[model samples]
Target chain A: MSRPPYEPPAQSLTGQIVDALLVLAMVVVTLYLPLLLKLSGAGVTKAVQAAPTWESLGQNAVMAAQWEKLGFDPAKAAEIIGSRFDYSFSWGALALTALVIVGYFVVMLRWSDREYRDVIAERFGDDRPPRRR
Target chain B: MTDITPQNLAGVAAPAAEPVARRVALKRVLGPAHVWGLGVGIVLVGEFMGWNFAVGKGGAIAALTACWLAGILYTCVAMIDSEITSTVAAAGGQYAQAKHIIGPLAAFNVGLYLVMAYTMLEVSNAIVTGDLIEAFTHNMGLVGEVDKRAFMVLTIVFLAWLNYRGVLATLTLNLVITAIAFAAIVTLFLYVRPWAPGETLKHGDLLTGLPYGGLGILAAMHFGLWFYLGIEGTTQAAEEVRSPARALPLGTLTGVMTLLIAATITWYVGTGLMPWEYLGQAVTPLYDAARLTGSAPLEVFLFFGTLFATIASANGCINDASRAWFAMGRDRYMPVWFGAVHPRYHTPFRSIVFFVPIAILFAVSTPLDQTITLSILSGLLGYTLMALSVVIFRRKWPLGTIDRGYVHPLHPLPAILLLALCAVTYVAVFLGYGSQLLAMMAFFIVASLWFALHRYKYVRRGDQFTMRWPKPNGY
Candidate 1:
């Protein structure tokens, strides 16, 4: 029946988080795609295996054999990725994330504003407050 | 007797019988997206780090199949958690939710179960990380062998330092780890000409006279349960999340689904590429697979990815587990001082300070397999209780909770079924390691004692709460 003595307010961040996710998405796409697919056809997987140190290692001796057949060359892949359409996707993704984050905060701002009606009514106005869920 | 009361005489209808007399504002932290990432990042990484080879290369077929099945059950658990959490949304994860619906003793036991379960997880992650570091170093011909205990201590110390910065810091670190883990998994899927499930199974299960025998499937599933341990972290953080009415469900579902798919594919492909015989024999299967599949650099990347994942697991656990103390301390269920948060960082400083050091000690002093076995067993105990809570709380309807999210369509059936699976795994654990009986029994005794002591404290505090609540006798 008794309310606890006090409850602390939840922590809020000054900087929005959704934007960070968007940036990560852009970064991963840029960095990951090239690493994954090699143009001369040796992908990042192959490149890692072919280096002399890896080729000479145990079991890697055989792994290197498979890497070559996969048609991966890291150098060529890098060139292709560098030449690819300048990060239109990154720009758009960030824009979209910004829009969504801003919209979410705006909605929450309005909801909290409704709660303040109680404070407003208790002190001055005749506004009836909304019932709590 | 009319539908009007003194307050409602002015044409205002009497308020419908309020289910709960107490109304509290649930805390708001991050949105569902970040919360989901934190929960998923916590469990997904360490399991991803360790199990990749077990499922991906060696027992790809069996391991992936186990993960898929486990993933389904995991989703069911998450859905059930979502339903319960939408209503409870308290700080204590499974412990509080179950306690309110069941009773203090039950909640206390749930907390105890989780403490052990998560502790096991910490040890397992440390051990796996130690193994990886050892393998990397040995292969590089740097050291003949790495001591597990030394590394465990290192891991604990490192994680403690990270967590000391507080929850926000851990959450940020978790995000980074989650992203890297996903990227690494996606890269594997994209680059590797992944093998078909059936083929991979046939190829990976190279261990003759294995795959389907007396409890091998059950044995592996028991361990594989690690991948799904912290799904409830989202639910526990329900009150803290922004708009938990929505975030709670979204975080639970998204986090589970994301981890499930990646885990499944990684398991399947890793298994298919490597001969199961070779995989079973190797020290750390996934790392071996990475080296075998690509080059030294990819192998190196796999190492880094796993390291990040383990760090994140420890980091996230430190963040979430510490909150238990904050809740307990704040409410006087435990010592009051533990409720103290760091002034500058706004974190559960003491709990964070406490968690990693003990975990690190276990990792360093205990044997790897022993630590792992304990971790999975303890986690299963918590999970089993949560699944059971779904059934119990739903049956007890008058506790004043409203669920505003999607309930699992099958309702009670999924939770019940999951409990059955949990039972099977529970028995399997006993079979896998009979020595674990001593550990399990010891933990049970300790829990019972703690439960009695906590109830004693509750009564002594004149807390205004009575025993036998939600039941026939009201103390």
Candidate 2:
């Protein structure tokens, strides 16, 4: 019902560094959690592997069926599709690496800042802080 | 509202000034949900189309990685944008905020970029919508299929009509269509189950090789950018929203979270059901996902769903683009006619009208991928300026009782991070389209030249606003 007093908290350099580190840790966990699970023989890797492959990457069952129905070997058509689907995943790890770093910055800002938490409560919650009797 | 400008406050009797000041305005009818609808809706087309192209350039693994990175970048930017827009809720969105924090030149460039981004996106959606409709009808065995150009022209006109009607109509239409599009995605997840049925999924090892390698992911950045491209359009509704201080932040955060989830499902499950390469080439991607199930009616449902999604996105673009035009016109940054509102409709009728023909031209002439690239290019420019504005605001405005709605946490850190991501995106753009960057530079040069030529008119007439500390209470 009432707005909070406007006082931008002054975060010291050390406090800022601590917050940054905390955020970095969260980012590392989230960004790498899937890969870690895969490395640990979790089903996520299998599921990811099950995603449509480059060999058959561009051919749907219908397209393959259509090709087969047209008297062309479905395998040949799929191979052709695979060859054309050209984007390689060799540097995909780098993308994940980038994700980890960016994710760290985002999660850090969202979680580590005290003012942001209060602001969230004010915007989304009851818009009022508890009152003293 | 016009009284906020220095020209009126100084009682300038300039002959060029019209009595339409303050008289031409939009009514505040939007609430928090409307904001969410507009935010999510303007980007709904990205869910249905455009993103899959990245898969062709980068394999599934590379594309997925690029997509998530973009998602994180946008999430960070949106969080900061939420705070800034809430602090200064203006219809002009980033342009208005930039004017107060930076200066008129920054505001002018930012405004041009915002309008360019929204309108070009509108054109891209129109182009894609026309393609999807043609593909769907031809597949449906319809006797007479509509030509893509004619279809685009009609779609543009129809959307302009909806925008010309009013904000409430536009938002309501967007809400209904967005809900349907979201439901379609959920239904796709339920029915197709891309993650499951493992053996049926082929080419599983393709995730291991990045064909173009590390830099390929950067080339695919625009594709990832597609998922959440226009989410910032929500801020453009600040002047039309009821209690924007509470609603803008709530709406943007909610919308961004929802969009992130939607993007994840779209990238993972949609590609999982169909090969990413196929999705890359398909005109109607969601329709193809339905067709993969080998169900005729489901495909039809998704065809309509994709249509609805495109309409919602294109409609939102018209609404937001018109407002940006209106704001710029109000500031005398462009011709005053663009700022004029239809007294009857209380809408920026001229602004809405002007974009339709240009959008149709692009929709007819430009390739979908190129249109998308240009749209994202404008968006990156706008985002870069906005992120810079946040950094400037932090250094200038001492947080106090100055109607401060929300101050972003960690102060300059988020802004710095956003700027870094933006810099990386620019690098990716330059690397991908080395020659195209020159064209953008030329466009910017032309815009600056025009601004320089006209800067004195507003200054001489006291029509321009000067930058001040603390942004003078409210934007």
Candidate 3:
């Protein structure tokens, strides 16, 4: 079936703002929720997969135990989860993500003004022409 | 929006210099996000060995040194490519632009080199993922062992099927994969926070010598190089992006720096606790880390993350390789069938279909190490050509003509130095790829022979693919 064109609502600016704000809030939650869940619990589904049978899940659990010997701590019992099964590893990982995100944001914002790179670029002469194909 | 008519894009091949009336889709050139996707994808496949190598055999100092060196090399390449990107954001990207300077043969070579490189990358990625999957399976107690050959076939079939849907499908795949993989990294990061407390500020130097006399900084460089592989991939997506002139350079920088920082942090925390040997031996080190953290959720996250890394990378390979092939076909170098876009997908579906089986066969047959070494060789070779091409293109058109208008700063130095350093790095990495140089030599021979046969065919048809290309003893 041919798809119909998307039509924007003929509404006031309020509608757009409301929609955008909703999206923004959703973004923040999505960004941090996964981290929070990971640090807090060990029962969360990993990700979307070709849904496996219960048998497969059960088998995987047995295998997960073997892995614990190799280094995988299901309850994060060793280090990440200091409590009986406290999962702090998940939180530490969150901190790491924050570092990367901040670094990326800072670099991008600084470069956006196109000022900082000028000194290095200036060495190349005024050959810096704005080209649009 | 105007609907696409049958008349638009009617011919599979159009004039190389201009887009046919309907062929030009009004979209933005690639943004930083696309570039990051491509780079990450390429690295995921292209530099699997380096990642493992740093963890396993390389010394702490070696790995650290490599990271710094890679950072410098990547920065230079980014600066150099930005100029070419600005000039030809609308031209045939690297292909058309290079043809203008070096002529048709070299142009054909560039496209062909790209195809070969991406194909190798996909196979390499599958092989790496296979290794990771094997570990995951063993951890799950699902099997006695995982056979690489079987895994290769599975990975190839899955990737081909996924890519058969085209660019959006692939992009969707890339985004999902990146998100999951990022999550895994986050999990590992969190686990390291309460690490052997009170030892945080002890190490004065980042490049501390490895315990038990390890590989030192070489391992770090290897991983660094691996991580930086696809940083400039956004250039190829110029035809589909929005305001690439503003986006490409900045995006390239953003994407690479993100991975760079991630690798650096991961290395610091990861190696700090686990022995490099233990880390190296792990089929899935991140997963191992997750397991060690004693978190069931993190374990699953790591497993799924590896899956995403592999799948997203495969999608990226398909998208990038197909586009280059399409360009080649349109230019009369490859079969015209490679140029045809799917009506529904608006993708070079035929090219991707052709590409997948080849990758599958190689992935299934070649040893994972061999596949990895060859992929790096292939990618580095293409990058070397691109670096050189940038220099030549700049020199040929010093007074760069402005259409929509974007330009580079200097003509000779940036391009010249980039090519020089790229040449040195390319050769060094090539040597670094294998214990024996014999296989590397053999691949070169194969590439050379293929070029020769193509040249002979071109001559017979009285249509030299190198009509304008520089003939360095028919190189």
DockQ scores for all the models shown? 0.01, 0.02, 0.02
Residues B1-475 of candidate 1: C-alpha lDDT, one tens digit per residue? 1121112211212232212223222235568777877788777764455453223211335555567667877877788877766655566667656545554455555665555556556666777778878878876678466775577678877877776765555676788777886776676665565545432233323323333343445545655665677777776565456566578788778888788777766665555555443443234555665666646777777778777777777766666666764555544444445556676666667666655655755566555445555666566666666676676666655223333344556777888878877766654444334335334544444444543543224322212121112221111
Best by TM-score: 2
User: Which prediction has the highest lDDT against the true structure?
Assistant: 2
The true-versus-predicted C-alpha distance at residue B309 of model 3, in Å, is 1.3
Candidate 3 lDDT over residue span A42-96, tens digit each? 1111222244432333323333433345654443322221211111124454454
Q: How do the residues B217-291 of candidate 2 rate in per-residue lDDT, one tens digit apiece?
A: 776775778889999999999878877778888888888899888887777666555544455555567777676
Q: Which pairs, if any, clash in model 2?
A: A53-B202, A53-B203, A88-B209, A88-B210, A88-B211, A89-B209, A89-B210, A89-B211, A90-B209, A90-B210
State the lDDT of candidate 2 residue by residue for A87-127, as single tens digits. Answer: 22334543543454344334323332322233223322323
Any runs in candidate 3 off by more than 4 Å, and if so which? A1-133, B1-32, B44-50, B55-57, B90-93, B143-151, B194-223, B403-413, B423-427, B430-438, B441-475
- Is 1 or 2 the stronger prediction by lDDT? 2
lDDT digits (tens) for residues B1-475 of candidate 3: 1222212211112122222133323233345676667666555432223465543334455565666677677776777677666545532355644444444445555565566556666777787777777777777788576786677778777777666765655665676677667666766676667455424311232223563243333323434566566656666676665666666777676776767776676666555444443444444556665676567777887778767777777667767777777766544455444556677666666767776666776676555544444455455555555666666554444442323134556655665665565544433333334221223333343433443344223211111121121212211
Q: Flag regions of model 2 displaced more than 4 Å.
A: A1-133, B1-23, B199-208, B459-475
Q: TM-score of every model?
A: 0.68, 0.75, 0.66
**What interface RMSD, in Å and to 1 decimal, does model 1 have?**
22.7
How accurate locally is residue B200 in candidate 2, as Cα lDDT from 0 to 100?
30
